[model samples]
Target: MRQGKVAEPVGAMVIPAQRGGVLFAVGGLNGELYVNGQALTGQWAEELRKHVPELSSDLDRLQAMRAEWLDSPPQDRTLALAGACTDRNCHTTH
Candidate 1:
């Protein structure tokens, strides 16, 4: 009999939010938030509202905050995202 490769359990799931506008990391020991390839918000901050229809106030707030932050034109949005990932205590190796 042939044996199939055992599937490893996933520590987290990356969910698409807002038609792939953002990605959320859930089901891990620590929750994290990312946007446009950048980690700009935290999970505890309720940034997942962007995906929820009923509780969207937090999403609106995030948009407004992002707008203001972009007004200055971040020197490097990619770096910012990387920094956020690190700030959120996400392991890059995974």
Candidate 2:
């Protein structure tokens, strides 16, 4: 495996809106979304959805939104989160 690449088929939950949005990683005391206590991002979550028909409808709707966002490139500089995010004077250690 290379640093910029991932070996596919990483197992994950393809949770839908029907389950009230992925009950397992619904956050805790610190308000961080995690799966089995590990931070799993959307790039990784896509691995879970690629093989399932579960989120197809969402994919359709989101694709349309993606197209619209692409049309307005400048205004859509960053992906928006549905949670609270405050800009602090501190640095984020990524």
Candidate 1 TM-score, true structure as reference = 0.28
Per-residue alpha-carbon lDDT of candidate 1 for residues 1-94, written as tens digits (9 for 90 to 100) = 1112213211322323334333332211122222323334455235445444442443444444455454553543333333333224233224
The window of 10 residues in a row where model 2 has the poorest summed lDDT is 76-85
Per-candidate RMSD, Å: 13.5, 13.0
Q: How far is candidate 2 from the true structure (C-alpha RMSD, Å)?
A: 13.0
The estimated TM-scores of all candidates read 0.28, 0.30
Q: lDDT (0-100) at residue 77 of candidate 2? A: 20
For candidate 1, list the clashing residue pairs, or say none.
Answer: none
Write the residue-wise lDDT of candidate 2 on 6-74 in tens digits.
Answer: 222122222334423331222222322333234335553464355434544444433343344345522
lDDT of each: 0.35, 0.32
